[model samples]
Target: MPRLSTRTRLLLITTFPLLVLFVTLTWYSHQSRQEEVRAELAERGQLLAAALASSGEASLMGGQFDELKASIYGMMQGDSAIKRVTLLDASRKPLVDVEARTSGQPEARYFEAPIHKRLLYVTGGGDRNVGTMGYVQVRMSATALLAKQRRRFYIELGVASLGLLLCLSLAYRMTDGFAASLKSSMQALRAADEEKRRLLQRVNTAVEDERKSIALEIHDELNATLIAVRLEAQQITALAAQAQPAPLAGQIGDKARAITRLALGLYNSGRSLVRRLRPEVLDMLGLQGALEEMVNQYERNHPDCHFALQAQGDFAGLDGNVAISAYRIVQEALSNIVKHARARNATVALLRRDGRLEIAVADDGVGFDPAHTAEGIGIAGMKERVQALGGRFAIATANGTRIAISLPLES
Candidate 1:
């Protein structure tokens, strides 16, 4: 599964708590509104009852019960909400039922109205006699008040929902903005990594080019001069053998031959140094040609040992880095063979197969334990050169020393 971006994760973490709070607040507000509505209805009912009771009490005390009954009847007619008003004796017997048509009607007759569902307040008042003066009861319909409260509750719910939606939208936008920023930063880091790899490759190429230049100078200039000096010394030795006193001639010949030997040694050392610095044939004759030249040189120097070169496929237009690394690895392997392998025969092979270039240098030599021997600078340098070209290096000595290098066909 793909991963969630950091901003999205953070937003979820932030929004979850907010959502919980919103739900909690909404629940609390809804409950409060319900209680307030109920309390408001009860208060309004109490006020109506109190006013009716006061009017009835004053009327009864003033000995004007009939007038009071008429006034309540008139009041009921003016306000439909006042379903009924009544005066009852202390024994709970009706003295007057204003909603009834007859003045002498019992209070139980007023209970016929559906307003009795509200259970409006009832108060008792009467004289201390065989029959009490009366009590008063008043009721008003609660439907309209209940409807208003319900409507308010619905409105509050809608507002809360809208507010929640807005909050979520804002959170989503912020999360998206943060995610975009993070993506851009990641892209920049990837680009930087690619550029760094390219720079390292260019540096390796420049260093290899300089090595080739120095090798050419040594082989073409220094080695040529040494060869000339050796030829002149040989001529001097031949001329001295032709004309000189007996003992003096012998001494002159020995000195001239010694000079020639020294000059030849210098020339060989210079040639070896040039090849070690960089093989000129790698650039002039290509990878295969370079391998062959190295094998021939090694064979000439170690006449007792056998050397061979083989090629399996065309290597034209191979990447320069691949060619250079392959050549250097083979060269180093052969040098090791001559200096330490004590080999009687060595084979160098170059092949292209399955979109890969493979180079192998093997020798039938007294191979040393690879684990016991320290990785000298030569092997490390060869490995680094191969890695710079994106290649792999391996060494095996089960039967004899064998070094193999492989590089991708494309750089």
Candidate 2:
């Protein structure tokens, strides 16, 4: 046998038993109808035979054959099932015979009743016995009864079949609905899995981009400072070996001061690079103060746009992951506004409400339609990151764009 689908198996499991039960009940009903029909026919036949024998007893004994024959034929005319009736004499000779219409009827059955003399006298009761005077026989055909039984059987069978079909149809519909719902859920799960993979790829890309940026900054700023310091040291060595030391002491001192200045610049460059890699400000000043410093830096860098921060919570003991993500999200949002949105004013909000960190970045700019436009790497990556941390993200745009994020604080 072929393997069945879940839907097919469920339907079979539910409907097979009902089908069997209905069929059994239908067959039983047909048999019971047949029995009842036969029983009724036999009772009717016996009654007709007994009544004829009693009514014709006097006429049969007086040798009045005409009156007895008239009585027998009259009953036969009224009952169409009476195929034949016979009046027998005491010597077993037929005195009268009558038949009713039997056109298109099946084989007949027989019922017999006896005719007893009305005169009864007792002389020696112990050993004397007398038999019945005469006999009456009736033959009946059950055409009508059998026809009724068949009609009843067919009607019952049809009803049972109809009920079975209805039940099966209902069960199939229910299974179909369940199968459809299950299919939809599976499709949704597949889509979510695909989205998760795409988000991971984007995250890796973002990391590579950050590394490249940091490498470029170090190469351009720190290397040049180190080369300048090396040139100053060589000059100091040349002046030290000079025979006229007093005359060139001022030159040596100037060279020493230049090297000192270059060393200080190189130190500042190293600190900036370290801050970019892992914000030590978050540890020194906490999340709120770090965010304040970040916003102040953005204002200084992007002089064309004004920025503000509204941080209203004790972010002293926040989870490290949540704090870092929140910082990156605000950083990306402000960069997007400065680069894409031709806006003059932007705001960043960080509030701790009900054991959760809520962050919102809003810019009064030429906002783009989210439904029509595809999200850029920054926004998409930010949204995926928040969701990965079991947080919610949303965006709204009318006069400006607002990206809202809510993160559950870890205990």
Candidate 3:
């Protein structure tokens, strides 16, 4: 036979105890029934013995014994289960003997008969003070009792078997129902996870598209207009340098210097805005150049803090998503370091090993509990972006805060 399923095994475990209980009950019931049958048979035997004793010798001489014997014979004639009845004297000598209707002849001495037959012996009553007067040996066929007990046993067995089968069937149905519900719940959870992933992908795509469009607008409209204004300012400065009147010369020089400062500030602000919209250097000069420019700008802005960047291997052919995610992660990490780390020095490292890319941003700062500080939006956003690309993100602090991200080359 094949092994049982888990549900079946569990059902059997639960049912075994009940099975033992039922069997014990059935055994006790059978014992009680046997005791009741034996008591009934003993009561009938005592009644017959008392009736025989009440008749006495005068009734025996008046042919009353013969009539009583005829009545007993008539009553038991139809019952094939009554084999024979014999009356014995105090000395154990036979006084009367009756054979079943089927037995052709009676044996003169029952002692000469076969010893294998089982008999029931009832002592005939004489007086209360006297001992047993004589023995009434009755042979009873056990076939009827045996048949009754066999039928009862079969009925009990059938009922017990049906009950066990019913219990097992109910148990199986319950387990199957639970399993189906669990399977459906798991499928729903999986569908929800897939939906979230697709939604994130669409959001990322839309954001990138908007950034590209804004960058193009800044380059075409803003940069072009600024250049025209700068050229016009240069013309004004040249004309001022040639103008007569020595007193107006210093005023013209001051006006020219103010225009120069205003023009430089506008140009620098536009460039910074365009770079924030989209890092054009990332595409033209690759990841290394873009990272170096980003670090230089940050270091210049925070003169008191030291920022260092190191790169191993050329990432010129890396996928755009990989390059962009790495760059954004570094950008967000540096921003957090400036805003939260309170550090004097920070390091950003990028390395490619065994066809995988690893980015680490570390700072010698007053580190806080990661679980508590993870509420920051910048850190959370970086983690989401990295994970969306099937990368691993981790932040740890032994001596200081260190954020590490790793992504497969293919992704």
Candidate 4:
């Protein structure tokens, strides 16, 4: 069976008890109605038997059996509920038997009464004694009354069923409406997430463009000015060698050497800034070479730590977004490993699997709980880059902190 939604399941859970109570109450009411009908039938049977017994006693004592028979037949003719009537002598021997010849099968209820007359005591003490004359037994038919009750019960059951169905329909409608509302809300949230990803991707693109522009400006303007200063200082050193006074010439040569040193140092610093702003190596070497170069630089910087790179599959002609996001994720992971992990060994792996790029960075060092780890380690930025490209990002810290990411390639 298909699984029920939360709303539907809750409705069923809440309704079950009420459903059971309704069934139990319906059955109890039906049984109570049946008992009442039977009791009334029995009461009428008793009253009828007693009345006939009292009236027929005089005729029975006089041996007028014909009148008693006529009286019983007439009573049965008027009342269809009466099934049979029988008169018996004091010895329990039946005298007159009268029955209603009903067409259909009829059920019966029986009642009996003793026929008696008041007689004076033999001692004439003024108190009367009772003498048994005969007995009368009456059986009343309960088929019609019971049938009416059954019909009423059937009607009640049908009404109850209709009400139950109506309630269920209403509940189903409510659940359906709730499910629909929930679905729409979820869809809206998904749409909002997509919009956010698009916006982030645009912002990343703009920022990268600005960085490239700044890098070009520094390479063209600042590097040229520093080179001119270095060239002028070298020319001064050459002129100092041709001066007449040896002491002055030596001192001027020393000052020119120091100025050249400062100019060269500033020039080198400017070149390094250009490289950081936008690494030209990425454009020249592709993702694999760029990553290998990065790992080498980190290893050179921190000789105490050994960094390894394992690259598989072709990285040529990859999408810029895929390459950059992967690069940034590995960059951040390595930075975190060096700064926080206090690791002696770190590994970076890149794979092209099933038209997607998979990147993993791990360090065999101290690990920290992700929940407690500060976002200053650039973990949040890496996750956003992956999410903006609609990829999966995961982190594990079993042995040490490991960041894994997968981004789709534009086919």
Q: Mind giving the per-residue lDDT tens digits that candidate 3 earns over 43-123? A: 544454444444323333343457656755874675544546665555667666766665323222222121121233467
Give the alpha-carbon lDDT of every model: 0.73, 0.80, 0.72, 0.85
Residue-wise C-alpha lDDT for candidate 4, range 1-411, written one tens digit per residue: 999877777578667876998889898988898898779878888999999988987888788888878888888778777888889999989888888897534454479999887675678566453788889998877777777888999998999988988887888788777878877887899999999999889987887789889999889998899899889999999999999798899899899999999989988998888877777888899999989999999999999899999999999999887777677678778888888898999999999979899998989898877588666638888888988899998889878878888898888
User: Model 2 residue 105 lDDT?
Assistant: 58
Identify the superior model by lDDT, candidate 3 or candidate 4: 4
Q: What is the TM-score (0 to 1) of candidate 3?
A: 0.54
Candidate 2 structure quality by residue, lDDT tens digits, 1-411: 899876787778888898788878877887888788778878988998899888878778787878877776777677666778888877778888877665735345688899877655586544322557888888777776677678877887788788788888899999898877867887899789778756764674577468557756666667666767767776675665563666587677667667767776776777677677667677788889988999999899988899999988788888766777787788789889998888899999999989899999999999999889888999987977787666789999889899999998876
Off by over 4 Å in 4: 1-167
TM-score of each: 0.44, 0.47, 0.54, 0.62
Per-residue lDDT of model 1, residues 198-255, tens digit only: 6656776788778778878878898888788888888988888887587888888899
Top-scoring candidate (lDDT): 4
Range of the 10 consecutive residues with the lowest summed lDDT in candidate 4: 101-110
For model 2, the superposed segments whose C-alpha errors exceed 4 Å read 1-267
